[model samples]
Target chain A: MPGVLVIAEVADGKVLPVAFELLGAARALSAEGAGPVSALVPGQAHAQELIARGADVVYVAPESLAGQMYDAWLPAVDAALQQSGADIVLLGQTASLGRDLGPALAFAHRTAIAPEVTALKLENGRLRVTRPCYGGNARAEHTFAGQLQIASAKPKTFDALEPDASRTGEVKTIDAVGQSRITVLSVEKVESEGVRLEDADVVVAGGRGLGDPSAFAMLEELAKLLRGAVGASRAACDLGWYPPSSQVGLTGKTVSPTLYIAVAISGASQHMAGMSGSKNIVAINKDPEANMVKAAKYAVIDDYRKVLPAFIEEVRKLKAQG
Target chain B: MNIIVCVKQIPDPETPASSFRVDEAAKKVVPAQGIPPVVNPYDPQATEAALRLKEAAGGGKVTVISLGPESARDAIKHALAMGADEGILLNDPGFEGIDNFQTAVALAKAIEKVGQYDLILMGRAAADWDMGVVPMGVATLLGIPCVSIAKAIERVDGKVRVTRVLDDGFQTVEAPLPAVVSVSNEFGEPRYPQLRQIMLAAKKTVQVWNAADLGLSADQLGEANRWLKLEALYVPKVESKVEIIEADSPEEKARILAQKLRADKLI
Candidate 1:
């Protein structure tokens, strides 16, 4: 029986955390009578960690597939699919590579891809997946109808297995090198300081209610005090009050931190979907009935400008007392 | 140069969650009262990308294509108002309840019928289905390369250069002409048409073509031809339970909320 293959995504030579989460999901499928779980690293990577986290086999491809460029990654993934003959393949649902490569690969195979699936199961030798749709207002369960099953799993939807050094797996180097017709002129990486939004335990997010770009300074201060990262809503990002890299919504980064503080956000369905998995939520909004306030476990129905400063000060005092 | 931009009309994504409803049995959204459908938010960004490329080329024809219901004409008209030179609507009863693959088939057919194009532009994803696969599907069928999530698109020596958004950063890549590009919101706001342009767009004849005109049969278009099966669609029930912090002043309210967090061991 063909099991699952994880197309582990890489950035700056580091295996993204989503790779391990996908292995966890793949292992679950294997445990349920699907065959062994194999991982495909499209670049140079250590197989020990992936193997420790449930991958039975790891195929490391050439470094050309390291970046998110579709043309660079597609041939390697295609070759892996054919060589491994895996029935189901998974990729991290990153906006850049996964979104671009998954569909193109599926189309190349004369099939289609299931995008941003939250949950998936192995049912009667087929793959059944649930994905959010309609701007996250609804979820649609889907099944691949006798086609090669391919999906981009949403980040944070699955937990990475606890790594165990005792586990052992085969690491094979594959020569399925990728060559792209597109010319890469230049590459520019955004200079980011502190924890990335995805890795942050606490996320202090602001919205259009901040009213001015300068307000992000205070939000950043609070994020710094909490040793967390700061994010923003689509509206605030579009308004140029914050960088688009920090936007938190369906169209932007999907963040699921331990604590998500939504400041002055209205909590549009799209925004909530991105942060819905947050373990706990707090809202500071003047509107009592705002969606953000309603969804929050703790809410202060007052102007964020009025609440944020004092909230920051109180948090500071409490931390100092400790 | 000639460019094609695909647009879609969807129920307004800005509708508050409180008013959004779904019929689990029928698997459809209950149209919120008095809210009209609008073009998918990202479609305008794609349109902006197309318009910018056309303008940069010194001269080019930008045609907007939409595969949707009769209301989809509004989406086509939207692109026209935003400096598109022509509009085409791929409308047919057979087009209803089709998947993205079928949608891509029809759009690719329409592009073939148009007979001339250097680039195809589309939003990264539609707000309704939000699958964002049609562009790639079309590009694949056409045997052209596709670059998605473009923040900037330029005509570099007759080749299309796109600055694409990646998971962590950005990369600038160049593809041959007639390639497909899907624009993201980072491309910046689209140009809002002036009154005169809107009036002119209203009068332009939007050529309507059905599935047959695209040489597609009814059997090739709808539910039976779908690649993926929809098992169930439902509005997930989300219970909102909030503990409101009440106090005489903002400072007091802040202090109380902090105390509550400490008690919960969250702070």
Candidate 2:
């Protein structure tokens, strides 16, 4: 059987969170007798972490791959796959590199492509992948009978397999078509405060109930004290109280945090789809009967003006003691 | 300045979801015909932005490219109706199931094949899959700086100033000629295509390039080069029932709600 290739994205000289997630999934898939799970980390980084996370073989290219330039990375990935003899390749869904690079790699490799896949399995030797369609309203299953299969794994939906401290793997460099046709003239990284919504372990989102954007300060403070991120319902975003980036719904980022706090959110199905997977949830709204309250592990019915300050105090207290 | 706007044809998502189905054996989405396809919402915004830039520049050429089945002509026509000077459609069976990466490569190839454009414009994300990855991939393939989620773009002599919507607020950046930008819906509503222009768009030639014509090998077109896999697909199940708490009096309702809030530690 052809071995599986796991493409790990390295950004700003660091292996991204999705790399570990892909490793875990690749390991599980390989364990089921699909093929060997070899990781392709196309940057100047140590591959030991990949090996520890269950990558049987790791490919590393030091000099030309460190930057998150898609132009440079595409050829690097193509070179790695060609050398690895991987018939099945996997990637993280929508990582900084994965989003742009994943599809290009698919086209380059001429393989069937599936993205936002939430689950994977092998049935009778065929590779099976599943992803949401119709804006999370339905799910579709795909099985590639061809020799090669490629898919992008959904983030925050799977556990990152634990690394074996003692596990060791080999790292080799592969020659690629060098000299990128495109060049990154310059790069500017945006500065952000508090936890990034993508990286947050906890997220507190508000809706129109917060009244205005200024009131979002309370949610921001609460998020800061919790070491989490703040989000808003589509309503809040539409009301111009928050930027679209902070909006949580079908059109925004799909977040699955350890704890999700919903305040004054009406719990539209689309918004729920984005965050329904949060391990624990709490909701606060004036409506004693709100859809979000039913989805919460804990529910509160009160004015945000009264409850927000108290919650902030409690979080501050917890942080202070720690 | 030559501005190229890449557009896509998609089933009108606003059509109730119930109208579609999967041809599992065929491994394809069965299109619900009769329902018209439109320019992916963001593409028009990008086109409008390009038009504005052109209008501001006094005059310039606006070329639109769309890749899909032959039906994709509708998308190109839509762009042409909106004042694009020319349109091209890349139609071929080999392009089916081509993921974002290949789509970008094909697009980059098309742009390169066409040759000479100062700016490439695109929507921040597509309605289908909504991965928002194409413009970046194309930029990478073309080796240009890509600014996504752009709310505005203004051309000033040698460069373009872009207002990017960041998570917290916004940031303005300037880039020299030859850059890729994915315009956001917030860029402003797109203008409607005029009647005479619509008629002219139909008669104007829509250049069709196939996988063969683009020199894209079968391997470079579809699943053979795909690098990602969907592990599984099932309807996300999240069920919640309404919570109704009736109060006898207005004051009592407020008190009850307040009590619930306190219990949850939200107040």
> What would the TM-scores of all predictions be?
0.95, 0.74
Docking class of 1: medium
Worst 10 residues of 2 chain A by lDDT: A177-186
**Chain B TM-score for the candidates in order:** 0.93, 0.89
List model 2 lDDT by residue over B27-122, tens digit each: 555667787876787889999998999898888899999999888888888889989999999888888776666788789999999898989999
Error of 2 at A132 (Å): 2.2
> Which candidate leads in TM-score?
1
Error of 2 at B33 (Å): 14
Least accurate 10 contiguous residues by lDDT in model 2 chain B = B227-236
